[model samples]
Target: MAASKIPGWVTAELFEDLLKANVEGFSKVKSFKADSGSAAGENYATIMLRVNIEVELQGKSRGRSSRIKSDFPPLDGKSKPVSYMVKLPHQLEMFQEMMKRTNIFDIERTMYNQVVPEIEAIYEEVGVDITFGARSYDLKNAKTDYVALEDLGVKGFKNANRLEGFDQAHTERVLQKLAQWHAASAVRVTTKGSYTDILLDGLYKEENRPMMTEMMKGIGSNFVKSCPTYEGYEVFIDKVKALQPVLIDKMFDFAKVDPMEFNVLNHGDSWSNNIMFQYDAFGKIKEVYLVDYQLPKYGTVAQDLLYFLISSTKLEDKLSKFDYYIKVYHENLVEHLKILKYSKPIPSLRDIHLALFKYGFFGYTVATGVMAAVLLDPTDTASFENFVGDTEAGLAFQMQLFNSPRFRKHIQVIMPWLLNRGALDM
Candidate 1:
C-alpha cells in the first residue's frame, strides 16, 4: 500500500496512536492502505493492515482488528479491501459518554446489536445474506472515535433526492419491510421492560420541545401565507397553536401503551433517504437495506409507518395507493409477529391505520417545511434565500406545497378517511 497524502486534518501520530491503543500485535506491518473514495470525510479513512497475531482484546478475543471492517465491496469498482474508519474522540473534542446518551448513537448500537442479528437470522433461514454489513470496535481507551465495519458496496440513498417512476410493487415491498422492522421493535419492548424504558425516556425528552415548537411555528405560518383560498388555513393555524402544548404533553404518552402487546421495535427514522433500494439487473428494488439509526427509539408503530410514507413518498403517489399500502403493512406486521412467537395477536391493521390518521399530519407538516428550504430547485436557490429573508415570503414558500394540487388531493383522500374513523378531532 502506498503512503498517500494525508489530509491536514489527520496527523500521522494520531493514526499510529489509535492503532496501538486498540490492537495488541504491532511486531510486523505487512500492508496498509488509506481510503481515497470521495465519500471519505475529513477525519476518517478506511485502513487495511496485515499484522502478526498477538493476544487479542477481551471483548474481541475472536481475532478482530482494532477498527471496523466490512465485507461489502467499494463503490468505485476497485478491489475489495479490509477497511477501518478512525475517529479521534478526545482530539476532536467530542464527549464519548454524551454521544452514547444521544438518541442517534444509542439507536445505532441497538440496530447493530439487536435488529441486524435478528434480520440476519431471518435471511440465513431463507438462504440469503440480506444484511447490509456490520461494525467491529473496542471502546477501551481508544485514541479516536472511528468505527470500522463491513462495507455494503453501494452509495447511500441520500445521493438521490427524488426517485422517479417508483411502482406500486416496489412501494408495497418497502412498506412490508418497514412493517417487519416495527413489529420486531414492538416485540422487544414487550419482552424487555428495561430496554423499553430507556427507549421511551429518550424518545420524549423535554429538550426536544423547543426545536419542535420552532419548526411547527415556521411551518404553520408558511401554510397560511401559501394558500389564501385554503378553506382551513385559519383553522389549521389555530389547531397548530392549540396542539403545541398537547404535542409536548403527549410526546411520551405512547410509552404508557402496554408494551406486552402494543410495542414493536421501530426504525425510528424510516424515511426513504435512510433506506437503500438494492437493485437487480433490471434496476428495481430487489431488496432494501435500512440505514441511519440516528433516531431509533420505542414508539407507536404508526409513528414510523406514517412518517416514512409522508416524508419519503410524494403525497400524490401515496394517496393513490393509500388503502393498499396500509393493508400490506398491517398484513406483514401480523405475519412477522406470529412467526416471532408473540403470544398475543398483533392489532388489526385498521387500528393502526386509524392511528395513522391521528399522527400522519404531523409528518406532512414537518416535511413540507423542511422540503421548502432544502428541496428547492438548484436554480431557484437565490429565490429561496430571498424568500426566507422575508417573514411573509418564507411563509408563502412553506405553504406553497400545502396549496399545490399534490397536497390538496392528499388531504381530500386522508381527511375523509380520518372523518369516517372519528380521528379528525385529534
Candidate 2:
C-alpha cells in the first residue's frame, strides 16, 4: 500500500482554523505538509501534518520556528511538530467495507466526544487527573469522514516493542491506568446512565461474528496443524482441536456483558500496538496512553485485563506475576471507585479472579492469535488483508507467521499455562 495522500479537504484554511482556536493571539497559517502517520494494513489511514503558523502577541507576530512556552509556537520558518494524527477510512477495499459495516469511526467519535470527556470529568471532580485517550478535535469535513486527534507522539509517547512486550514496570503502569479508567467509566454509568448503543458490543457483535468466526477458524486450524511440528505440544493439539468448533461461541460469551455481573467500558483492543508509553530521561515510563477506540465495548473488566496480560506482557512476568498483577489492578480500581463515591457494591479481588477464570478462553484465543501479530517479524510480509484473506499467498503467509520461532516459543509456554488453568475446556 502506498502512503495516503493528503485529503482534498485538508487545506491551509483547516490548519489555520485549528491553530487559531487553540493558540492565543493566533494570526495566519504560513505553511503545512501532510505525511503518512501509520504503517500499511492498519485499520485507519493516519496522516500527520507539520504545520507552520504565525500567532500575534502584543501586536507582534512570530512563526512556529520561534520557540514558545505553549503547545504551539509563533510563526517561524520551521514547521511546528505534527500536532494532530488525522484518521481516515482505510485505503483497502475490503477493510473499507468492514470499517463502514462496523461503524468503527462512529463508535470512536462517541468514545472521544462523549465517553472520554465524561470519564475525565469524573476524575477531575475527585482531584485525580487522568487521560484515557488523545484529545479529539471536532472537524466537520463533508468530503470524507475523518478524526483529528492530539498527537501523543508530540508529548513524547511511543509504543513499546511488540516483540519485547511489557516488563513488570510497564505492565503495572498500564494496569494502574486501566483500573482508574475502568473505575471512572463504572461511576459514569451510575451517575449519567448506561453507555450508548454504539458501545454495546465491538468485535463479536452479532452482525460481525461470522467474519470473526472465520478468522478464529483460520487461527485454530493453523495452530492445530503446526502443533505436530513442535514436540510436547502434541498433548495440546487434541484440546485445541476440541476448542476450534466452540472457540467463537466461547469468545462471544466472554465478550458479552452479563447483566448480573460487574461491567465497565473495555478498551476492546488492548494489545501492545494500541497502547503508547512516554518515558522520562532515565528511560522509565512516565505516562501511558490507550489508543484505538475503534473497538470500545461495554463488558466485564476482565476482558481487557486478560487480553493485555496474555498478549502484551513478557512471558516471565506473565507466568510469575499473573495473580500479583491482577491484585495491583484491583487495588487501584477499588481505590478510585471509593474516591469517586461509587454507589454500587465494590467488586472484591475474588470477584476479579473468578471473572478471570470465566473469561480464560478469551485470554487463550488472544494468546494464540493476537500474540502472533504482536510478536510478528516486522520484516515479514503481513497485514490484516492477507491475515484474513483466503488466497494462496494469504494462507501461506499465515502459516509461516504462526510457525515463526518467536511465536512458537511463546505458544509453547502459553498452551501449558492455559491447560493448567482449564482454559482449554469447552
Candidate 3:
C-alpha cells in the first residue's frame, strides 16, 4: 500500500493477522481486539490484541494478550496526515546509514538481548514486571522488514502539558533508569570481547563527515530563520557556519571512542518522547520503559543522563534539582553495577559531572530546538507563522523557542559548560 492509501480499519486487520501469525507459532488463529486511538498521524491506528497460545514455559501453560502498532497510510484522495506538512529531504537512507555508523543500533540490540534481561530478572525478583513482553515474528515473503511485538497496552505518555506536579519525581526515576541501562552495557563491553569489535567497526568514518556537516547546517539555518526571536539573521547564519565543523568533528571523535575503553553505552537519543512510563493504580509513577533504539551507541554514560534531564525537564527548573537528580542516577548506576558483579565499580560521580561539560550542549540544543516545538500548546500553532516568514507552523514553533525562558536558560548553561571544557575554543 502506498503511504497515502491505507485506512485505519485495514491497518487494524493487518496488525491482527500479523500478531496472530507470530504469537500463535503455527497454532490455530485466535481472537483479538483493536484499541481505539490513532498515534502520530491520522493514518495510523494503535491496537491491542489478546490471544490464546499453547506454549511450554517452566512446565506451565498460560494465555496472554498482547498489543501491537498498526500504522496505515492515508486514504487515497483524502487529506494527508499532519506529517506531510514538512517536506523531508529524499536523502533519508543516506542519513540513516550515517546514523548507523555511530553504532547505536548494535549497542541497543546487545543491551536488549543481554543487559535488560538481567535487570528484568531483578524486577521479577522484586515481583514487578517493569519490562514489556518480547517480540516474535516469522519471515514474511522472505523479507525481515516487518515484525510483530506483543503489545504492552500503552498508547503514549500523557500530553506534555498535562504532565505537572510529578516533574521532579519523574525526572529522578528516568535518571535512575538510564543509569541501569548504561551500567549494564558498561559491564557487557568490559566482560565480553564480541561487542567491543562491533563498537569499533561501527565508528564514524571520513566519508560521513561532509554529509554530517550538511545536515547540521541545513537544520540550523532552517531553524534560525524560521523563528523571530534572534535578531541579525546574517550573524546567526555565520554562527551556524562556524559551529558546523566543530560540532561535526566532535560527534565523529566521540563516535570513534571504543566502547570497551570508555565503559559506557549511550542512548543516542534519551529524550522524553523516546521513553514510556508505566503508572500504578493511583496514577503514581511505577516504572519507565526505554524505547526507540534508533540512536543507541557507545559513549560516556553521562551523555545519556544529561540528555534525558535536559530534554525532559524544563530548563528553568533544572538548575534547582540538577544536583539531586545526578546523585540519584549515580546511586542507581552503582547499585546495578554491583548486582551485575562488574569488576569495576561505578565511576566517580565527580568525574561524570565534570565530563558533562564536554557534551552537555547537545542536550540543551536538542531540547530547546526540538522538544520545545512539541511541548508548546497546539492552539498556539497559528501565531508561529508570525515568527518566521515562509515557514511551516512546526518549524516556526521550533524557532520561537529561542525566545522562551527555558531556551534562554539552556543557552546560559551550555555556554559556560562549553567554555569550561574548552569546546568553545575548538
Candidate 4:
C-alpha cells in the first residue's frame, strides 16, 4: 500500500523515534512498509496497520543508498526487521458516533496505560512472571486517538481459527492466563481500590441500552424467522419474540454483580478473535494472550468465563468439559490469590457454579447473537455495513449469518444446554 494511504499521524519521523525507544541500540530508521493489519470481517471499530521497518544501528555506516541490504550483521550495521500493529479510529460516521457513546478507544488506552500495568505490578511484587497483552507505545500524534503495539506475530503468537474454535489445549491455556489476570486484578482491588470509573458495565451500559436493544431485536427477529427450519427449535420462536423487547434489559440485569458474589475485572469480549495463542515446536500450546480490552469491565468473573466457554470453545468439548474447565480456572485463581496474598475470601468451585447459572442469560445472549457472528463463514464477506447500513444487501447478509449451517449446528446444541440450565428463563 502507498504511504499516502497510511494514517496521517504515522510518519517516518514518528517511526524512527518509536524504534529508537523500543529497540536496543537502535539509532536511525532507513525506510518502512505500511499495510493493513487485520483481515476483513475480523475487526470493525478500528483501522489496523501492520508496519515493518528497517533501521540502522547506532554505529551503522551512513553510506547506504538502496533500501534493500544484503548484510545480515555487518561490521557496523545490522538490519532489524521490526513490526508493529497500529490501531486508528475508523473513519465511518456511524462507527465514530458509536465510539463517542462507547468510549472504546479511551477504555483501551486506560487498559494499556494503567490497568494492565497495575495488575502486572502485582505479579512482579510476588515474583510471578506473566504477560497479559502486547507491549504498547506512546503515540506520536497526541491530538488524534491511536494505539501502537508491538506485533505479537513477530513472536510467533497467532490467533486460533475462529471458525474452528479452541481445542482443550488452547482452551486451557487461555483460561490459565485469564485466571491469573483475574487473580491479580482482585489483588489490585484489595490493595489499591475498585475500578468503578472507567470499567463500567460494558456493552450493557444504560447509555448504550437503546442501541443494544435495537440490535438485539433485529437479531431475535431474524432468528425467530429461521427457527421453523430447525426440527425441534420451532418452539423457541415465540419464546424469542416474547423476549425481543426486554432482552437487552434482561442482559443488563444478568451482567450486574450481586453483592455477595466474587468479582474481578472481566475481559468483556472474550471470543476466539480476542485471544492469541503461541505454540511450542512440538505443536503444543504454550502461552496465550488476551487482546482487545476495549470493553473490559469490573464485574463477576462469570461474565468472562461464560462468554468464552459459550462463544469460543469447540462445540463438542464445551458441554463435556464445562465443569472441568471451571475447575481448571478456579484452581489457577486460588493458587495465584494465595501467592499474591489476596486478603479477600477466595471463591470456591461451588460459588463459581452458582454464579454461572445466576449470570447464565449472558451466556444465552452469546449463544444466540455473538456466537453466530463468531461462527460466520469466513468466505462470506461480513462488514460493518451489514450491521448498521439499511441497504437490502446488508439486511440479507445479516440474516444469512443466522442461517449458517455451522451456526445452526451450534445453536441446536448450545440453546438446549442453556435452556436446560434455566438460562432462558425470564
Candidate 5:
C-alpha cells in the first residue's frame, strides 16, 4: 500500500496539453497538484486534481485554478476506493489480478469521448436540448487515462446523500432525464449499429464470470439471511437456487436483445452516488448529471432503470409508487421518440411491468449487494487490510451491513411480490 509520488492517474505532458488545448485562456503551465480525494464516496480508480496556471492573453496575465478528474488509476485497490473487500486482501488481489486483462479503463474513456456525444446528438435533432454526463474536457484513454472536468461543485451541482435515497419527486426528475438519455440511445441504435458491438466485446468473458457468480451468491444468501419475516422463505430459496445458473445469462442477455425489444445504452452503473443534481429557485431539482460510465452496457432500457431504482430509491417509496414511476418513465420516453419520428414499438406500460417482473432478480441482487455499498456509512466503514484478512471477521462485517431492519424491509417488499407474480419461475 505504498503511496506513489506520481500526481495522479495523469501525466505531466497531457496535463499541460489539456490547458493549452481545452482550457479557454492564454495559459502557461504553472503547477499541477493532486488533491487528496475522499475515500468516503469515491471508488477505487478515482483521483482529484487542481491545476494552478497563469492566464496571459492580450498582454494581461492572471492566475486561475482548474479542477480535474482522474478516473483511471493503478489497478491496485490501495489507491482506489475499494474498502468493500480490501480487508479481505485476497479478494482485492483477485479483483486487481482480473482487471489487468480487461479493458475497463478503455470502456469508460470510449463512453465519454465517443458514445455519449452521439446519444446527445440524437436528442438535439428532435429539438430536445439534452445532455448526458457532466461537463468534462481533455478526455483521453491511454496508459494513464484522465480527464480535466468541470468542477461540478463550483457549478452548483451536489450529490444526494448516498445513504438517503430519492423520494418520489427526486425519482421523477431523474426518471425524466433517464428517459431522455435512453430515448436518444435508441435513436442512435436505430440509425447506427457498430457501437453496440464494441460495447459488447467480451463483456462476460470467461475470466470474469467466476467473480460475478461469487458476488451474486453472497447477495442471495445475505438477503435470505437478513429477512427472517418473509413468508414462503423455502419457496424463495428454491427458486433463487434454480435461477442461479441462468441468472448470469439473464443478466448479460439484457445487453443483447431481440431487435423488436426496446433497447438502449444503459448508464450501467446508475445510482444516487454517481448522479449529482442542482436545484431551481424553489429548491426543486432543475438538472441532473450522470458521472460514471465505466460499466456502460447496451441493454433493455428497463435494466438500467431497475438497477437505479433498486439501488437509489427508498424501498417504501419505490414499492408504493412502482406503477406511477414506470408510467412516468414511459411517458417521457414516448414523447422524445415521437418528436424524433421514431415509429418502432416503444416499451409499453405492460412491457415495463414484465421487464420488472422478469428482472426482479436483478433488482434483488443489486439491492442486497450493490445497494449495501450505496447506503454504506463511510464514517464507520473500513478496509483496515490486516484486520479483514481474518476470514470470519471480514465476512461478518459485510453481513452486518445488510442485516439491518431497513434492509430486511426492502427484501420483504421486493421478494414477496416477485413470488406472488410467478416472476422467478424458470
Candidate 6:
C-alpha cells in the first residue's frame, strides 16, 4: 500500500494535491497508503488511497501538542479508501492513437469538468441530492486524467450482479434518478448556454466513428455467426451482416434526433455494472448512482432507458416491469422538470413509449457486446496494456468474448428480438 505502488499515470505530487483539495483542515499529510483491493476497469486503473494528516498550522496561536485530542471524533472521514482512477492511455502506439482519436479519456474529463458542474447546478436548483462519478482533480485542464470520487461502496451502494442483471426494484431506483438528470437537460440549455468546445459524446464524435466501426465489425461478425440457422430469420441475419459495413454509421444516425423532443445528455453506458444502489433504513432500495460517464451521449432518455433494460435487467424482469419502469421515469421527468422550471413540454407516456421503440437500435446494437463484457470473468480478461499489445491479440480477445457461453446465451434472445422489432435494419 506504499505510494510507490501507485500507478505510473498518477504521480505522488498529483495524488497529494487531490487529497488536499477534497479533504479539509489537513495542514500536513503524514502518511498515505494505497488500498490493496483496487482493480483495473476496462478503460482505467483504479487504486485506492488511505490518507492521514496532521492539522499543523504555520503560525497559529502557540498550540499545545501532547494529548490534545479534539472533541470532533476524528471528523468521521473513514470511507472505503477513496478510489483514485487514472485513465489508461494504452502503451501500444497504435492503440494510443485510437484512444486519442476516440477521446475516451477526454470525454470523461469533459463530463467531470464542464458538464458535471452544470449537472450539479441543475440538481441544486431542483433541490435534490445526487452524486456523479469520483471527484476529479484539475478537471478543467487535467494533464494525466485522474479522479478522486467517493466510492459508492463506502456509502453502501453495491453493484448489481452482472450475470443475473437486476430485478425491477433496483431498475426502478436507477430509472427514477435517470429521469431527474434527463429533465435537467432542459434547464441546462437555458442556464449553461452550450458546450461546443468540448469533445462530443461517442455517437456524435467523428473520430470515434472509425473506432466504433472497427469494434462493431468484430462484434457484428460474431453476432451474425452466432445464429446458425433460424427457419424464418435468415433475412434478419442478412440484415445484421449488411449492417456490418455501416452499423456504426447507422447508430449515429439513429440517435441524431428525437422525433418528439430534443435529446438529453444520457449516461450512454447504463448497464447494471455502471450503476450502484443503496438500501433505505427500511431495507428497501432508496438511492442510485450512475458511474462511468466516458460515453455520455446527447440523445433521447429512452435511449438510456432501453439500453439499461436490455443489458442490465433479466429477461423476465424486463418483460414484467418494462412498462412500469417507463412510467416511473416519465413521472420523475415531469415532476423534476417542474422543479427545474422547464418550459418545454414533457413527453407523455405514449410519446415515451414510441421514443423507446424508436431508440431500440441503441440498445440492440450494443447490448450483446456490453452483456459479453459484463459476463466476462475478470481472471480471463486482459489488461488494456496487454489487450492492445498487437492487432492479433486484440482480435483474439474479441473472439474469446464471442465464444463465451454467457455471450451466446445473451444473443439467443437479443438477436431474435431485435430482428422482430426491425431494430437492426438500416
TM-score of each: 0.64, 0.90, 0.65, 0.92, 0.79, 0.81
List where candidate 4 sits over 4 angstroms from the true fold.
1-5, 60-77
Q: Model 3, which residues run further than 4 Å from truth?
A: 1-144, 154-166, 194-205, 222-241, 258-262, 364-423
Candidate 6 lDDT tens digits, 1-426: 355664544434555555544543334444444443334333222233433333322233324453454221124433223344344343455556665656556677778777877787777765776665545555333454444455556567777677777877887778887887787865786676644444335646676676656556655666566656433446566776677787777777875755357568777888876787778899787677777777777767776887787777876675557788888888988888888888777678898888777767776756656666665556434445333233576566666655667666666667777777778767
Deviation from native of the Cα of residue 157 in model 5, angstroms: 1.0
Cα lDDT of model 4 by residue, 93-182, tens digit: 767767777778888988988888888888999787888998878866545677888799988999999898888988888889899999
Q: Would you give me the overall lDDT of model 2?
A: 0.77
Which stretches of model 6 miss by more than 4 angstroms?
Answer: 1-11, 24-27, 35-85, 139-143, 197-203, 229-235, 258-260, 280-283, 382-392
- After TM-score superposition, the amount by which residue 165's alpha carbon in candidate 4 deviates from its true location, in angstroms, is 1.5
Model 1: residues with Cα > 4 Å off, grouped in runs: 1-103, 118-151, 154-166, 189-197, 210-220, 227-247, 250-261, 358-426
Highest lDDT among the candidates is held by which one?
Answer: 4
TM-score of 3: 0.65
Each prediction's whole-model lDDT (CA): 0.49, 0.77, 0.48, 0.79, 0.62, 0.63
Error of 6 at 413 (Å): 2.0
The TM-score between candidate 1 and the true structure equals 0.64
lDDT of 3 by residue, 17-91 (tens): 443433322222233223322232111101112322222121112243334332222233322111000011112
| Error of model 5, residue 267, in angstroms | 1.1
Please give me the total number of clashing residue pairs in predicted model 5: 3
Per-prediction CA RMSD (Å): 8.5, 3.5, 9.3, 4.2, 7.4, 5.0
Kindly list the per-residue Cα lDDT of model 2 for residues 1-426, writing each as its tens digit. 232566667765666666666664465554465666666433222333433333344235434333343455434543333356777764666666667658777888888888888889998998888888788877654366667788787789988877888999999999998999999989998988888787877766777777777656766787788888775887778888888888888877876778788899998888888899999999988888998887888989888998899888997787789999999999999999999999999999999999988888887878877777777777435666567766787778678768888888888888888888888888
User: Which pairs in model 3 have colliding backbones?
Assistant: 67-151, 104-296
lDDT of 5: 0.62
